[model samples]
Target: MKNWIKHIVLGLNYLKSKNLIHRDVKPQNMLVANNVIFKLCDFGICGTLKDSISSTHLGSMRYLPPERLGNICSYGTRSDMWALGMSLLEVSQGYLPLSSESIMSFMSHMKNDWQPDIPTTLSQQTRDLISILLERDVNQRPRYYNDILSMSSMTTLEQNPSEDERNLIENILKSLPIPTPE
Candidate 1:
């Protein structure tokens, strides 16, 4: 999972360097090759970051950052980071972190400053990374991929988790109930 995340961050970093934002980041948009390497796709909704801001609200509603869904105006790379965090959380748990019975319900949840419940089965570093990534305040979230990579959680992960830990995570994932279509 960390390997996949690293590739996603690398992709985001490349986009950041070019002042681009992959507005629609989700599992559907992430293509995995050979069951290992991953690549972000679907650039149709990507937008350019102008002066560190983007006014357009074009992205999968479920993965959008709080600022994009609210009246906040400074949507930029941080929005993509939120989506990346959601994608990572979803991948780790085998389901979307937030589920809504209706669009209104989802909007309400987003409006209430709801934070997903990170599973305790995950390592503290993993949970810490996800928690900050999903922060409701865009200003508080790491603004750059380098900033994210610099986090102790991210840096520790880059060193590679032990094989036993990997096995334990794999087991935990296997134990999670598969989510049914809503």
Candidate 2:
């Protein structure tokens, strides 16, 4: 988990340095290899950082930041941090942190202060990181990727997904249908 977060932070830093923002940052777009390497994928919705904070409500509904709903608020790196927090929760709990049948329902939940219950097993550092990442007010969240990377208690990818678990994941991925490019 620590390793995954580290890689994500690195990737986010790279994007920020390039003046880019990945409008969509979710588990589906994150790839893990050897249970230690984290790779950020899917740049389809990525846009210039300067233009990211504009009148746009783009990104996967499940991972959409609170500011992107209804109000003409602009988003920035904090949006991705929200998604990252969600992804981390999903990984730790083996399910989505938020539950809703539709985007509207999800947004409603967010508006109502429906934050995920912190897991009992998570370390204090991890918990702190999540709390910051999932803050309702984007301004209250960590402003830079280094803020997340600096934590000493972060878990590395090597600590998660035992070898057998990875094999099962490999099999599952192999069973999925591949979408050919048009």
The candidate maximizing TM-score is: 1
Q: For residues 1-182, write the lDDT of model 2, one tens digit per residue.
A: 56667877899889888888887888789877754567899998787866545345688877876776646367788888888998888776767865635667778887666777879787787788888888988889887877777666643435565565565457646866999999
lDDT of 1 by residue, 79-160 (tens): 8889888987887777886653476777778878688888887778778888888998888888779987776655666445
Error of 1 at 34 (Å): 1.3
Give each model's whole-structure lDDT. Answer: 0.78, 0.75
The TM-score of predicted model 2 comes to 0.81
Regions of model 2 farther than 4 Å from truth = 51-55, 154-182
Clashing pairs in 2: 2-155, 3-155, 3-156, 3-157
Backbone Cα, N, C clashes tallied per candidate = 0, 4
Q: What is the lDDT of residue 40 in candidate 2?
A: 91
